[model samples]
Target: MNQSVFQKAMNEIHSRRLHASAENERRFQEINTVIPELAEINFQMAQTASRILHGEKIDKIRQQNLQAQRYARQLLVTHGYPEDYLDMHYTCPYCQDTGYFQGRYCTCLEKEIASLSVETLNRNTQLQLRSFDQFSLEYYRGLTKSNTKGETVDCYAKMKKTLDYCIQYARNFTAHAPSLLLYGEVGVGKTHLSLSIVTEVLRQGYEVIYDSVGNLTSQIEQEHFNREKSDINTLKLLLDAELLVMDDLGTEFQTSFTDSVIYNLINTRLNRNLPTIISTNLTPGKLEEQYDERIMSRLCAVYQVWELMGEDIRMLKMKERRSSQYL
Candidate 1:
């Protein structure tokens, strides 16, 4: 949980409380102007505490308060308004929009924190535009690829299976879900499918972080050297997020610091059994060449590796657009 995120959630909860209070006040003023008898009943109800302080009998005051409330309701209904219209309507009734209950944070507040944390992490991502439904198999039609087992297979069939698997993975995602490594040439829909999974997992209310490897590494490095003047612990959030999607894995500016940070990130998340999705243009050989053996070993042994097979979808789309313009 990031401190700034927590503070933002608290601020939102405070605003909600203020809004509810303001609305309640507004309704009271309206009803007071419309029905003066209800206003008198309200004043009498408000005097319960003062009467108790003045050594009045507690039971008598409690009875009087109940009678006043009933009379107020009757008056409201007789005046053609809902009996409970003047009641404070909190967004979350359990906490009265206060964000806490019984000395602990409420579930509604926790949900807000999780939602805001995801939003903060994905602030720069176009997460809303991608989905499994938007992924097309037409690009891979009439294509074929030889699998590692050396069998000729239809690329369209292969991609269809890959898409279905990704959909199921997203639908069934949990914190303990297995990590994934999606590898293929550039523009083969790796980022598309990864973002699709991210969209579904987020809809399921999990905190997900998605970004390019280069961008994430750069931020981590900047924060490490105290060059980025922000309180957010980017590395910690990446490690602690429910799901992390790292795109374009081999494109980062390599440095001793970045290499160490990347290794630590991969290693720590694996050790904690947290799920991660990594998309890269690098193959197994190139990945091993770029990262050290430890990182390679974890990815090879633990991650569910998927090779996306197709010609560049973006290039195909561009050619199709060009052909369409001529017609």
Candidate 2:
């Protein structure tokens, strides 16, 4: 989250690209070489500037950049011309290689790539469990069980506001942001909002993780029952991430061990001041009934619970689309 990590990443990127990694460096240097055209251009600029140094040209040394531009165009042509290219090309597109865009983080995008770098989400080597951009709000309908006039205006407003709030929170997250619990029915956008936060926080340079409750509990169970120590490493990852998000909490296969683990996780995080986000279809009262009041009450002290209400937005959208087709 601080600046040193970014500096290290930059150094690593350069080291991986230059000098000892000559073949890799060659790829970029090929674009930046002081070729014959570039050398001629530089020689002309220096010759004219020497006159200026002696007070001869007087506000009339043809701009060095202008000379470079002609050479750049010729270089593009020799390589096979493309009309309307960059007036000037960027060598390192990030930071313009100046290292910062404006006053904020120059390697701004480094944050975005970090969250996905985690083993479960690593886009480089495998398919993601889900993707943030693929989330659709069309799954939520504004209706609760009481009545359905398609969807309630109140529910839509609240969910939309919630989405906006979650986005803002992710953009502005700091070390002390409170933990969150997104409680709702199936397809209510809880997972979407949670994934969105993970995506944004990673972009902002914090390590975050998202996992299903069932997968988490199963891993914990295996780690506990097995004699070998290495498999328990999965739980270690969960406990170690900067922000850990557990999705579909109540739906996980519940055993006495799982119940104890869940309580321990919530309580341990609260004690350590580590942050966690949990999503479940269970209500607060239902959670108490399912896991016992003591564990539920302790969670209430440290987490903000958001109750999501509405029909599945996905189902509503699908029906709406089919109705439109019939019409």
Candidate 3:
């Protein structure tokens, strides 16, 4: 949103120049028949000035009237006129604000518009994405004291390490990076960490598409079988997004069609070298039991599974919120 504002302001410069030229042409037209010589001189002076601005080194008789007009603008304050009146009329002294130099677009205007287009595309995405700074370490539950000299860790310490890994992964993510599997208990910061990665990747100018397995299952089904033979929009998003986030992967409604679609989506992206991040509460044993060994093995081969071990952070937050309310 903030980026869009900057681009829009820059585009306005071209619009102002166009408006100034149109107004000047109209004024010259009105006086052409009544004062032919004066009108001709003024039009010719504007033409020559425009040429000079456009990089043409032409020698033409100086129009004293044009210089007099400039002097009037420069000394507007001394003559009791508004200080900004001349500047308000600042048609680019370079291109007469026409934005073309030598029959080509000005460098300054082209650069601004190119930047604006990037910001405009970036604006298509939601900007206030969840980030690492806002992530809560409190989400990882209690841990017993760690022994000195390379001791075994507790659930809290293990999950804390996972959080740090997630932060680092997001910070340095590339298209070639390995896919991530976040298999864990419910409400143990799985979704939170995934969103944090989404936010961070967005800051790096990567397009990310977020969808839960359940939502995606229904969407693909409707697009493929229920309504249309082909859905171009769905295909474009899945193919073009820099990162594809599939949350709660194993909980979608089971069907032969859903199963095949899910498999194909993952398989397609993997073959194309696009990375996918999948989060699920199902254990590895359960994944094999629920989805066939074929699907599970394909996923395991393609992704580095991170099994999260922590109590429900949602319950803890609810308890804290209740306690604070009583106080």
Candidate 4:
């Protein structure tokens, strides 16, 4: 919990409180102008406290206040308005948008803090550039591959199914959605599809982090060693995000620190039953070799593994550009 992130969340809560108050005042004024009797009732209701201070019997004043409130509500309903239309409507009724209740921080405030933290962490990534619509299956057209079951599969058909699956996965994503292991050779759209899922999941208002494993590991290493001046608890954020997407899994600089960090992150998230999406160029065997049995066992047991197949779409696009330039 960084101080700046907490302050930002508090500021948002203050803004919501102010908006609710302003809107309530506006509604009261409008009703006062439209119905003069409501103004009189409101005046009487406002005088209850002063009347009690001036030696009026507390029960009598309280009764008068309740009667005034009932009359006001009746007036509102008779005039085609809800009884609570003039009440201050808060975005969160629990805290009245003040961000605290019962001497503790409200759940709404905690959620805001979490959302803001994810936003801060993802500020550097280009999450907007990738989408499912931009992913094409044309690159796999007329290609064929043999599956593990010793059956010939049409690459285009297989990839089309993969594309559809990714789209539906994004569209119907939830916090409890199954974790994913997207493994394939370079430029087979592993990054693209994973990013596509990330964009949609984010739009659906889940906290998602998308970054390369190498970059994230570097940041974690820096924060862990106090080599960088950052207040954010990077490892905690990664573990707690609603959906964590780590790309290029095996490309990070290997060290004891990175290995421990990666293993802890995976194990913690799995224990918490949170969803994570990992894209890697390494096959299952290579991944086991790169990490160890502990990491591979968890991934194989829980993750929905998808093996993307195709030639390098980047190379195909480059050739297309060159041919167009010649023409």
Most accurate candidate by TM-score: 4
Please provide, for model 4 over 1-327, each residue's C-alpha lDDT reduced to its tens digit, 9 standing for 90 to 100: 468998999999999999999999999899999999999889888887788889999998888788888889999999999998888899998999999999999999888887787788788665554898899877897656643334567889888888898999999998888889988889999989998898898789788898898989998887777854664777888999999999999999998888888889889998999999999998887898888688899899999998888889999999999999988
TM-score for each candidate, following the candidate numbering: 0.71, 0.58, 0.58, 0.88
- Relative to the unseen true structure, what is the C-alpha lDDT of residue 127 in candidate 1, on a scale of 0 to 100? 55
- Positional deviation of residue 300's Cα in model 4 after best superposition, in angstroms: 0.8
**Residue 307 shift from truth in candidate 2, angstroms:** 1.3
For residues 1-327, could you state the per-residue lDDT of candidate 1 as single tens digits?
A: 447888998899999999999999999999999999999889888888888899999999888888888888999999999999999889999998888999999988877776776677678665554899899988997656554445677888888999999999999999999999998898989989999998899889788899988988998887778754654667877888889999998899988788888888888999999999999998888898898888899889999999898899999999999999999
Ranking by lDDT: 1, 4, 3, 2
Taken over the whole model, the C-alpha lDDT of each candidate is 0.87, 0.66, 0.69, 0.87
Total backbone collisions for each predicted model? 0, 9, 1, 0
Error of 2 at 161 (Å): 2.8
Q: Which stretches of candidate 3 lie over 4 Å from their true place?
A: 1-128, 143-153, 226-231, 325-327
Those runs of model 1 whose alpha carbons end farther than 4 Å from true positions after fitting are: 1-10, 19-117, 142-151, 227-229, 324-327
lDDT of 2 by residue, 156-224 (tens): 666666776787778778766788988877877787778778877877777766678887788778877
In candidate 1, position 74 carries an lDDT of: 90
Error of 3 at 204 (Å): 0.9
Q: Report clash pairs, candidate 4.
A: none
